[model samples]
Target chain A: MTVFTLINISLLAILVATALTVSRLRALYEAAMLSALFSLVTACLFVLLDAVDVAFTEAAVGVGISTVLLLGGLALTRSREAVTPRRRRLPGAAVAILAGGTLVYASQDLPAFGSADSPVQRHPLTDTYLHQSQEDIGIPNTVTSVLASYRGLDTLGELLVVFTAGVAVLALLGPLAHPVDARRRDDLDLVDYRVLRVISAMLMPFILLFALYVLFHGDFGPGGGFQAGVIFAAGFVLYGLVFGLDKAQQVVPRVVLWALIPFGLLLYLGVGVVNMLLGGSFLDYDTLSSDPAAGQHLGILLVESAIGITVAAVMTTVFFSFANRRATR
Target chain B: MIGTHYVYWLLFALMMIGLYVVISHGNLLKKLIGLTLFQVGVFLFFISIGKVDGGSAPIVSDDVETYSHPLPQVLILTAIVVGVATLAVGLGLAVRIFETYGTVEEEDVLERDTTP
Candidate 1:
């Protein structure tokens, strides 16, 4: 067997084992950790498949922030899952089996794995994005070009969805505030372990710095705004977990997060508006500057920065809401 | 020759396992885990489909002659972010459900609903 096949087999085995373990485990904490493991393995798989950007985001958001957020949610609720009765399980299993079977059957018609001559590779859109984009966008990263410029509207819609989710959480959980419970203050301080405190304090600055790197590096590499934003929030999340929630809040206060949430979305929308005023289509960056390539560069940078800001604020907002609920409860 | 499709088959199995967990488990948290598994499995499947026989990473470099399609990678990249956002919202709702009903089990919450 080739080395690639060996790596794939091992990673798949690990993924399967982790999934099964997570499914059977009743303890919420263990399950959450296992899910994080699942994400890490998936990220590795993405790397093997030559999708470095997806791998980076998956590692940062899926493995890192999402796991932390799950734990935060668990803090407000029970850690152990109630036992599901055996008889009630069949229907769901049957449906899943049926769906899996159908998908596999459909896959029979697909071209073999990793064929360079596959229909997807021969598609005109792929050819255009691969070759024309370099000259048009003047960015090394074709994915960013396609994402931020070619499919600008879809990205706008995605940003709005994330914004809406943030708004919904704020509505549901109310504002971020300190824990009302005197007992909770003591509970929060438990994370004030001297070792964790000192280590995290040392790490938070570097993490934030790395986040900035990811945000700006999108033009040339796998790093981008979404991954950077999550990393930024994750730094604060680590701070919150280590110190007390109140201390973390003092650092990033609820008011600032709230304001920043909409500010980022508006910034993105503003870019489009400017384009319209400049005699171009909405989000068409060509009119933004004298040189079309330069315009594309500037538009992508602004839009990506906007994405970073909104995503960071929203994720931090959701975490605070969850933590706030737990404390107040 | 057909055995080469093992990767896809394995991914399908994982997806089914995730689906089964979401469907069969009564606990809300377990259900969320299942949903996540299902989603990740789909991600793997997409990435697998995009792989070329000997293509390098899609990043533009003069050294590489063949590259996998960048479009699917971009699509999946956005989907990953959306997936996490959706998971956050779902978890928030789950927390609220626990707060109101004092349990994260679906059956327990259903039994407590006596508005009729």
Candidate 2:
């Protein structure tokens, strides 16, 4: 077996082990941490599969943001899962086994792993996306080209879905309860950690800067707005964890977040509308400049920035909503 | 050969474990974690399908002869973001449920609802 295949199998085994452990754990906090480990392993597997962009995103969102969100949810609620009678386990196991059996049966017809002759690899559009994109979009990263241009409408929808989820969470949780006085000794914020405070304070600017670099460097590498936005939110989240949510809010207040929640979606829509006005189909960037490739580049940058804005704002808002809630026993 | 399709089998097993957790677990947070596992399993399946032998990442490079399919990566990319968004919403609901019913266990919440 090749080294890559060996690595792939090993990672998949780790993922399975983590998933099983997560399922068996009754401690919600431990389960959440294991889930983070699961995401970390999954990101590694994605890299092995030659999906660096997806791997980058999975690491940022799944490992970083999702873990923190899970922990925050755990803090707001109970940490231990309640025990129940085991009599009902039969049905769940039966259903899972039956469904899994069906999948295994169906898998007999699937293309072998890493086979070059798979239908997906053989499809005409694959060639177009991999080759034609260079001439048409003039971008080095085909994933970015397809995401920001060819499937721009789908991404716009995805952005809307994210925005809607943010709005829904905000409505459900309500706004952050008024920030308690910073000087008050409270368990909510880590006011006593001198080292964490100093270190995080030193790291905050670089974190934000790295996020911006990821956003702009996507055309040439393995990141884009989604990953960058999550990284950005994670930076603020780190700041909040150490310094306190109130300080984080002082930097990016609630009003600004509310405005930003829809601004990115609106900006994306406005770009499309402008494109229509310029005598091109909606979201066709060719009309944005005399040179089509340059226009495509400009349009992608704007839309990616718009995506970054909405995602960063929504993620921070969601984190704040969860963090600011008063824990009720 | 088993070697050719072992990944699929393993992924299906992982997905089934997630399914079992979602169904059998009473804790809302546990269910969400299960849901995440299930989603990630699916993501891996999609990404694995897009892989080509001896291919590199989809970033265009003259040195690389083959590139893994970018379409699936793009689809799963958005799906990951949406998955997290859904998770946030689910967690929010769990918190609200805990506030109203005083527990995140499904059976307890149902018992309380019926008793009231």
Candidate 3:
């Protein structure tokens, strides 16, 4: 077999193995770790499939932030999953198998994998985005152009969704409403690990710097607002995991996050409003500058920064809400 | 030809396994794990469909003539973020359920609720 085929087979095997192990493991911690491993493997698969951008995101958000959030949730409850009754397994299995069988059979009709003439590759939008984006949006990354310029409205909606999720978690947890209780401050500190503390302190600046790089360099590379924001939040999460939630909050207080989150969304909306007022359609960055290319660059930068701010704040807010709730319990 | 298409079968199997786990598990966290796996299965399937047999990554460059479809990558990127968001919300609810019921198991929570 060719090397590419071999690599694909091995990665697929690892993914399946990880999934099986996660399902069978009773310990939630082990399962969480395995799930992170699964994400890592999936990221590699994305890489193998020539999707480096997705791989970058899968690695950062999937493996890093989500794993931390899962662990945070696990902290608030028991580590061991209760034994499911055996009788409960049959119907779900049958239904799942039925669905699986239908899909597998249907796959026979799918165009051969990676065929050049596949419908997706042949689509007009694909050609437009791939060829015309350079002239219209003036960005090297077509994904960035398509995401920010072509589908700006969808992305704006997604930002609002992330904002809503942050709000919903805050409502559920009710931690942000109350300040960090001074009396319970001692209960949350984990100062014992001098090594972790020192390392996180050393790495925090670089992580934040890297987040900035990802945010700004998105037009030229795989990094973007979503990935940058997650990385930024992850830096704080690491700090929180090592030091304390209250300490991390001091670095980014709830009030600031609450204000900044909405502000970021407003910034995005404001950009579109300006575009409309400038005699262009909403989110039409072509009118933002004397030259349309320069306008695209400026508009994408501004909007991406907005997204970055909102996403970072939302993620950090959600993390704090969960972490604080765990502490109080 | 069948060998070339084995990827779909394996991915489908994984999807079913994930769905079965979600359905059969009593623990809310296990359900979440299964849900994530299911999502990943979809992601893999989408990414697989975008690949060109001898294509390179879709970054605009001088040397690469054929590249994988960028649309799926863009779609999947958003989907991944949304998946994590949904997972976060679900986990938050799970935590609340655990707090109220004193257990993460669905049947146990149900039993506790009906009794009260």
Which predicted model would earn the best TM-score? 2
The segments of candidate 1 whose C-alpha lies over 4 angstroms from its true place after superposition are: A176-184, A327-329
Model 3 clash count equals: 0
DockQ score for model 2: 0.89
Question: What is candidate 3's lDDT per residue for A31-110, written digit by digit as tens?
Answer: 99999999999999999999888898899888888898899888888789877778988888898989998998899888
Interface RMSD of each: 1.3, 0.7, 1.3
| Per-candidate local distance difference test | 0.86, 0.91, 0.86
What lDDT tens digits, residue by residue, belong to model 1 across residues B1-116? 45568889889989999999998999887888899999999988888888887787788888888888888888888888888888888888887788789888898889899655
The residue-by-residue lDDT of candidate 1 on A72-156, one tens digit each, is 7788788898777878778987898899899889988888888887889888988788788988998988888888899888888
What TM value does chain A in model 2 reach? 0.96
Instruction: Write down the worst ten-residue block by lDDT for model 1 chain B.
Output: B1-10
TM-score, model 3, chain B versus true chain B? 0.95
Tens digit of per-residue lDDT, candidate 2, span A254-298: 899899989999999999999999999999999999999999999
DockQ of 3: 0.73
Per-residue lDDT, model 2, residue A5, is: 81
Query: TM-score of predicted model 3?
Result: 0.96
What residue runs in model 3 are displaced by over 4 Å at the alpha carbon?
A176-188, A326-329
> For candidate 3, what is the lDDT?
0.86
